[model samples]
Target: MKRGLMIASALALCTAGCGGGASGTAAAAPVPAPTPAPAPSPSPTPTPTPIASYTPAAAAIPTAGIALPLGKCVNMGNHLEAPNEGDWGRAIAEDDFTIIKAAGFTSIRLPVRFSGHAAMAAPFTIDAAFMTRVRHVVDLATAAGLNVIIDMHNYDELMAAPDANAVRFAGLWKQIAATFAAAPATVWFELINEPNTNLTNAKLPAIIAPALAEIRATNPTRPVIIGGEGWSGIGSLATLPMPADPNVVPTFHYYDPFAFTHQGATWVTPTPPLGRVFGGAADIAEIDRNLQTVRDYIARTGRVPFVGEYGANDVAGVPVSERINYYGTITAAYASVGVQSCAWAYTNTFRLRDGDHWIPGMLAAIHTTTTLR
Candidate 1:
């Protein structure tokens, strides 16, 4: 399940800075006062202009300049996103990158729950030790020639109390952006994992605007990913506020026909009914309809889409054959629409592995180029 940190209010904050002033007694400037000007009227205090809120417009959406290979990508989930390394039952090993690359994946999305390793107070400093560990993992992926996407994951606190946590949320990105300022272009930043709760379509722009500005200040041209409201669901794609930056890539998650993908998944509220299956003609048509929603959005906005997360839970009790078919069909659908994607996980629940070995059928379903190993 996605986790979050409870952030404190920042209402009492104050800013400090430098100022200069000058004063003089009666006789100080006698030379220049020959034609003494009438008593200078007090300069009217300048009225402060209220900052204009950002309104996303279609004309403002720039062409995406950065190209992320849309080919096979996988999520290194349940690792860094956990409370600690190995706590989620899978500690990422350096060799994992090698395996990912060798298996034909061109990128890996690293979901990190930064709130767990950050200060709860102002400045919200991320734990240095945690950052070091993240850097090491990033280095591993980059060295293996796989593009790495670092994302803020499971920040439920920010979602629930967006107004109060705005400062801390921006602070978190400010630190993250600065920390990865010098990272290679292959290293990408995803603003946040999934924006839900009070951070809905209507309120998303206010929260993300400052965060995007914070990131742009440091890594100006880096490829940053932004998702829509409602857990980044495809239905919300049209309503997502697109930033003016050309390097930004819009993303959405796909677990369409939720009953089929999340069947028997306990984490999902009112748990999805089990025994749901995929691969029939009707199922394929329904999947196509969902993919078309994304395709239409991309065409309308001219912003490339990235399917950030997609997968079926292994324990959903659907037959392995149906799961394989689902993965293959969805992967093809994504390819058809020219959208990039990363499967749900490398290990843990909804994983592609059973213990240390690759689940042959699952691997083949994801990477069509390779056979079962």
Candidate 2:
């Protein structure tokens, strides 16, 4: 589920033409065949050139790493990332953090649209008022004893024209990193929501590398989350270049079998068909196959994998029971492979709430083995 309206349009052009020449009136003179040229001798194989191996940069804060207990998180979605709080049907009230903390959630993933509040020119400055509002939310969540992930989200302009905005993107992070430099380690920074458009897998590392360096300069020990292209899809994880900093956590968003998870979502183009059900034997197998790849990556590199976002859209037509089953299967699959996950949202779009109360089934599915400390 994306933060704002998505417009997808494709244009294609096709043309065909054929020409025929009239038959020649008289017989044409025959041209003599030229003598064949001798074949060239076979070329010898060139010696193979050895390529230099890539080594990740050593961690500035060697002792900083992801601790397993940071489990069962939820996105405070449809809130700060909007053009304004409450404009998107949800607002970050101080008590919302309390409700989340009381519901057994150990972490909160706060998505902020810094780009909307930033200047379009060089040294792109984030609005002071907006930064203050973000700081207030961070204060509220952190005070509630929840680990917080302040993510850069819904920066469509930047994603569309990354090169033009690379300096501004890094500029925003430098200010943010400095602002939160003194905050506790529980507060984590996510470089960007999902690198796409001009920022393909090959191009993403170049953009992120500078922003990361800026963050390290200010807060060297803080844990930072980074995801791959294709909207950070789990399958794209393998293509993500590992950051030199060891404290970085490679994140992926899972909405496997998109037809099932995003069914009836109005925001999606040609909206996926409705009535798709989940949790069959085949569904479980597919889930396992997807998660196994992440597990394998974790085994190869000691870094733990984080499912930064995962949830099914809550369409009115989809059966509540089916939604619960989908959530349960995904949560269980993550647990089976020791991957940390955060549900897509707390109270918007794919919400777990009705008014101020949580839907018991939805909460139960996400809090599967997690106990509130």
Error of 2 at 133 (Å): 0.2
Model 1 TM-score is: 0.79
Report the C-alpha lDDT of model 2 over 1-373, residue by residue, as the tens digit: 2322232310010000000001101010001112312322223323322221212121111123453345778988778776677766657777988889888888989888888898878788889999999998999999999999999977776667778778888999999999999998899999987665566778887788889989999999898888777667765667777787767877777776565676565444445566666755556666667757866667666666677777776666666776777677677666656666788778865778878688778887663333221
Would you give me the overall lDDT of model 2?
0.66
Per-residue accuracy of model 1 over 1-373 as CA lDDT, tens digit each: 1112111111111000000001000000001111223332222233322221211112212244444554678888678876677765668986899988887788889988788899999899999999999989999999999889998876768867888988898999999999899988889999887666567778878888898899999998888888766567776676888777778888777766565665554443334456666655566666667767765776687776767777776762456776777677677666655565678778765677777777778877763212110
Look at candidate 1 and give me any clashing residue pairs.
none
Alpha-carbon local distance difference test for all models: 0.66, 0.66
Q: Specify the poorest-scoring 10-residue window by lDDT in model 1.
A: 21-30
Model 1 whole-model lDDT (C-alpha atoms) = 0.66
Error of 2 at 1 (Å): 14
